[model samples]
Target: MSVELEFEFEGILYSVVREFRGKAMSANAKFYKNNSLTTTGAKEVTSAIIKLTKMSKDAFMHTLFASQKELTSLSTLKNEDRKKMIRKLLGLEKIDFVEKELVEKSRELKREIEAFREVLLGEDEIKLKQEQIKESVTVKDAIAKEVLSKNEELEHIKLRERSIKKELELLSKTKEQKQKLFSELELAKNSKSSEILNQVKLSAELHQLEHKQEELKKLEPVKAEYTALQDQIKEQEKLKEFHLKKEGILKEQTLLREQYTKSKTDINTLERACEGYEEFVLNAKNLELNIAVLQESVNAKHTIENELKAEMAAEQKQIDITNAKIAKLHELGSEGACPTCTRPLIEEYDNVINSLVTVVNETHQKKINEHNKQLQNVVTQKAAFEAEAKVKEKEFSELINSIKVIESKLQDLKNAREYFVHVEQKGVKNKEELKELEQYGYDEKLHNGIKSSLTAIEAQYKHSLSLETELKRLVLVKADLENVTKKIEELKATCQNKETEFKLIIYDDVKHKHQLDEHESILKTVESKTALLNEIKV
Candidate 1:
């Protein structure tokens, strides 16, 4: 069914060779007359050839000598060919001019050939044959004319007879067609009447059902409204209950505040009492230090007095021994004897005795003076030591007072610390309780929020529930519409069936008419033959 073509032009000139389905076409110089190496030239040329054959889009012209330099050079050397090649390469040549030239040349050649053939046959020879041809032509014409006239007259009579016969056949077919149409019309009338009665009865039933559906549709909105109102009332009740719970929580908060205030006051009082106890303990410690200082001062005085008495007794014994030595020296001086022999003294012995007595008295005096000076220095040192001891005793008393105050303060501070610790502990316990109560309050509020949200959602749910019911009703309505559509489709099918039957009846009538026309034609042909025989006889 589909033909494909490939065209190739092979030769020294632009001649075309077209191939299709293994069939090849070889065109001569006439084919190359207007072709060129251009898309438009090829298209015009291909179109001209395809008018006589079946060629496809794959048609083209290929020049064999195009790529050969020697042949191209030779083709370029010819003046006319060079001009034509240049025009073709530049796409400036018109194919219409070439096609016109070819047509003119072909006409001129045909005329010239005909003139030469006429010359080859002499005029006398032609005239003799023309006369003979005229005689034969006249005889043939007369016989053919007579035969044609008879045939025409007989054909006319046969046409009239065939016309009458076909008219009779058409009348008969028309009568039968009327009877069949009347019967079909009767069936259609009866069916339409039955259908109309059924439709009336169903319409009444449908109207009653639609009326009940309308009543239900009206009641749906009212029921939905009542449900919504009920949900709102329930939510309001929950809000009231939440408010009461919040009020109770506020009361508990107030009680906790009072307890926190009382605990702080008790802690403050304990701190002040600790300060007073520290002051009392400091005064008692100072008194005990003063008593110890006085006892030490008295003991230092007794020790100094005892040491002075022992020194005075030793000095007295030494003075007594020195006086007895001075008395022995005086008695020895009164004797006046020789110092070495124990005899009565002369002038030299007296001198020696006086010197000895003077030396002993001087030694005794010096010793007494030294002892008194040393005793005075010892008494002064003892008095200074006693004063220093008194100063140290005063310092010790002050230190003891301060230490006792510190110890008493430490004890009071411990008591205060314990009291404060107890209050702080109670405060911590209260803080923990408050924390728990705050958490509980927060949880209650959160729960209330959740309940409110749930109430709101439930109200929304009730509304959506009604919408769902309406959607269900709409779905049912859609189903009814679909059923009505189906009934309409069935009626359309019946109409189509009726139309198809009518078309079949019309086709039968057309076929019978065609057969009658053929029978009339045959009868006309027979009558025409009889008329021709009668004309020949006459």
Candidate 2:
């Protein structure tokens, strides 16, 4: 005879075959995941079942496949053995271990608390430390005030020292000036007689040159006419150059005008294109904000759905445990002891079983159903938010594209405006230059006539310059002699004034040095006190 069994556990399907012939038995099993073979043979299948269900083979058998003979044998066992077996079947051994660990943790926590109490400060000690801090703060404040007063005195000393130094500098300058004026007075006195003799000679020569100058003065009109003609020729040359520059400017202005007109038209077109730019940008920003908000909503919903699914899985596991406990209770009957507390279940058997049923039905299963509903709701919300986000994203993309095009046009418009202004400024500068150029009025024929007259009188003009040069030398020598006499008298007066001024300024170098030393000593004292102030602590 052969027996085959098929079952599903934790979303996987398993197939088992057992054969008995001639008092020998053979067994094989296989499991599938997603309709594909995963494990084969008895050992592999057993291992896979243990791994999937998180239970040992014995416990799995006791919980799910206990036979009548086994149940009878379990009833006949000793109390301790029966209790241990039941505890293992119901997965309550971990509870005993957890209880032991909790007791140890409690003792550890109590010891830590005692240690912490030993190190904590008492109320009286805390108050004493506070008083000490308060006294330190008072001392620090007093020191700070003293420092401030010293700084004020130090600043006053610095001001007085500066004033004294300025007076010393003025005295030094006065002494130097007096010495310089005395030297100048000595040099001028030595040169005074020689300068007087030279002045007399220059006066005699000046008379002779003055008679020659009268002769040269006759050619003054011709020379003046020659100079005027040369000036006119130079002006005419400048005018010709100006005329060429004016033509170039006119050509440039014409090009500038064309460019300005074209730029104006382009600017108008660009302005029209950018008319609704602000509104489009605003709408795009709003859409982006909405999309971000929707994305957040979708993410939140996804998180909530995941949480709900996790909660449902936890609830389902709890329900499964409760159902297992209920089944074990039924199998133990009224004579069994509780698996968790190890109490006899004679009178409270129904109560224990009903309570486990109630937990599974009213608590765990109910929570699982609620979590399912919430998960479905969250999933639906996520889908809706995602759909809305997609639509908004599309709209945002379109808006961004439009904004890019508009921005490009705006940049073009900006460039056009800049070019237009540049052109306008260039035109204005050229017009001003042209206005200045227009002031030069040139007559070529009159210029030629003036050139001929200047050429004819050039010889007489050259002859007069020789006598004029000699007369200029005589005049310069006479002026120099008069300047020397005036300078000698001025130097005498300056030397006398400087000698009196030097007598009035009294600068004692020794006293100034002592004052500087005193100021430095005060500064060092102030710095030391300031350092002490900084070091003060509360």
Candidate 3:
């Protein structure tokens, strides 16, 4: 027959089972504390079970459970509060019947409250409906009084209609006489308007004839100014070839300026790329150091693990040796002979053998537990190191990739520099042309020339075209600069991200290695204690 008992403390559940053999019973139990025992503030439960068969039919197991705290110590609390606390201390299982009763009663009360609330709502609805009916009755009475007053007003309106019909007949006769008088008045007004219009046209013609001489005198100076502007236009035509040559030199200057700016940008980008590569290289070196440390820590864990394995094997060997010795003793004792000497086995030897075996088993069990704990720590350290190494290895690969991209861009920059040399040759020849123009003394003064005004305007148009072309080129160059700036920003962001990730990997790897060292030290202490505990003296 087997019986199981359960205990609960601070929300943690524990159970124990005992088996009875034949008609005899034994009470043997082992307890394991929670893994969070040291960290959490929960109390450990210590329980005792006693089974006694006062009667053969009534065998019962009596269990008494206690904790690190006592409910009786709550003497200063109020009576009800102390009782409530005592109930919580009893825990969920201890007060199962009472809690079920409370839950059922609470549900019944909740249903009763809902029924009462429903009755109150029904009464409120009835009151609201009665108010609405009374208001409808009052509205009906008001509408009835308004209808009666409107009937009296309809009688007065009929009497006024008869008097209006007589007045309308008198107005129709007077309206005919008034219309004839209006027709005569309109004829006189149209005749007077025609006479006034004829007078206004005659007066306007006389005024224009009087002003003709003054207008001719004002035009004489304006005609002379037009003649002078035409002369200035003709003189400016002599410089058309000079202006065209100057336009070419200005175009070359603009192109040279753009190329120079591009060269400066290329130099800056190369410098930054070099710096980024060097920084990443430095980071790679640091990663190597971290990897070395990690490897060393792994080696240390392996050494500890091997030593633990050896210790366990030695314990097993000791157990095997002890068992062999016991077997020999048992065989010799039964045969009534001693294997070491030609004498009978001593009684004292039996007692000594039992004590030795008990000590060996106890020590072996304790050492094995300590060894297992240390071995687990070493395994965990190795696992953590390997995981960090994986990420570090991934980042190192990314760093190499980044370096390759930068190198490719550097090659592109070198090609651009060769293109820049070709542009420089063109710029130098244009600069020489600009010097020649300077020596000949270019003049910008415009003189009036009516004979060549059209040609001068053509020269000005060509200059305007050159100005517009330069403006368009400037806008394109600005857009290109923005694009280059954007590319630089993107490259900067990528380099920064790679550097940060690589550094983080190295930093984390170092931290993991440091933790492994700490674990190794802890294992070393455990090993020392296990060795001391398992030591056997001859």
Candidate 4:
């Protein structure tokens, strides 16, 4: 028996032939691309079909040619096996496994949610804690009030103790004064005889001190003369210092005057050098303006040149297109059709060819000639503008150089003028100061004579000062003797008064200190209670 099959797959035609003679089989196949044979022989044709279809031989056999045994097995399959086979065939087994995993993950998430719910606190417990806090605050407030009352009581006790302490301190001071008075009285009694003997000797010394005082009184005129002479010497020394300062001022004035003259001369020279500053600056500005104008003209010419060149290119392109149409018309003869309209040439062929030739010569070629003329004009204008711009740029550059030189000269002039002003002001100030210094005259001869006389008088005054010091000592000693007698009487009276006052005071320092300690202990106890209350509140 022989069998032949023909089929098409993916735009390719395939053919197969098989012959079987008592289980001795032979097969041949062929495939074609676009009706052209691609592969021959069963194995080569099968491989080509498999590569084109992207399928294996077994898959191809099963998909395209199912066996009778397979059909019978499918009919006899159980429903579960059928479903399993369908799932395997459709690639849905991985989806089933993923679905099962998702279900387990969902159960785990549910459990985690329940566990989290258990760990969270309920609203009622939070309210109970808030109520406890309120009660604690109330108790703390009561304790705080008690502490305030205790503190006030402690303050009262402290004030009373402080008053008592002040009284005790005054009493102690009175006792010390009484002891001091007693000591002074004993000392005065012991020194009484010595003071009497001193009075006798002091009287004799007083007579000698009086003679020294009289001598000092006679030398007072000489001391006055010496003081006047010293004043004159100081005046002369100040005058010498002023003269030296005046000499320095004169030298400075001379230097400043020279600087002023030089600065004035430099300012004049710089001013002359910068004489045409404004004119040169204006020339530079004009040159820059001319250059800018020339540049603008050049740019305008460039724009015109570009436009003309583009127009010329378009015209030339049109001319070439027309010439091509004419050539095409000539080549088409009468039998050919028009390329653009797709019409039969017939009798209009020569007319069409003539029209194209006319367009090339009259229309496109004429436009090209006009564009060329305009382009040449633009080129000429561009060249003229560029040349003028170059000239202007050169002039601007030279003007800028001149402006820079002028500006530098002007700056020097400004600096010199400022320096001249400063020098002139300084010279005027120095001149005024020099005049002031010249007003104070000095006489060196008179100053020397007075200084010599003051030296002699100073020696005499020094001797008188010694005598005067001794006289003052004796006078102070006499006055001390009289004051001592008066102090002794006053001390006896002060002692009596202090003794009475001392007996009147009855302050008990120990008792007052004990009261203060009691108040402090009570304060500490109140503070401790307050601290405990604060802790409970927290």
Top TM-score hit: 4
Pairs of residues clashing in candidate 2? none
Candidate 1: which pairs clash? 9-62, 336-345, 337-343, 337-344, 337-345
Model 1 local distance difference test score: 0.59
Clashes of 1: 5
| TM-score of every candidate relative to the true structure | 0.26, 0.39, 0.30, 0.45
In order, the Cα lDDT scores of the candidates are: 0.59, 0.79, 0.61, 0.77
Compose the digit string of candidate 1's lDDT tens values, residues 107-191: 9999999888855868798999999999988887887778777777777767776676776676677667766765665565566
| Residue-wise C-alpha lDDT for candidate 2, range 1-538, written one tens digit per residue | 6666677776766666555556556666666665677877778877876887798976766567766775787888999999887776676888888999999999999999998997899999999999999998898788888778777776776676677667656656765666666676556555655666766776677678778878888888878887887887787778777778888999998998999899899999999999999999999989989998999999899889888888888888888887888888888899998977989999999888887888788998888888888888888889999999999999999999999999999999999899889988998999999898787666778767877887898888887887777777866866776786676577566657656765665556676566567667766765775666566422
lDDT ranking from best candidate downward: 2, 4, 3, 1
Candidate 4 clashes between residue pairs 3 or more apart in a chain or in different chains: none
Model 4 lDDT-worst window of ten: 15-24
TM-score of 2: 0.39
Summing lDDT over every window of 10 consecutive residues in candidate 2, give the lowest-scoring window.
529-538
Candidate 2 lDDT at 154 equals 62
- Report the Cα lDDT for residue 370, model 1: 67
TM-score computed on alpha carbons, candidate 1 = 0.26
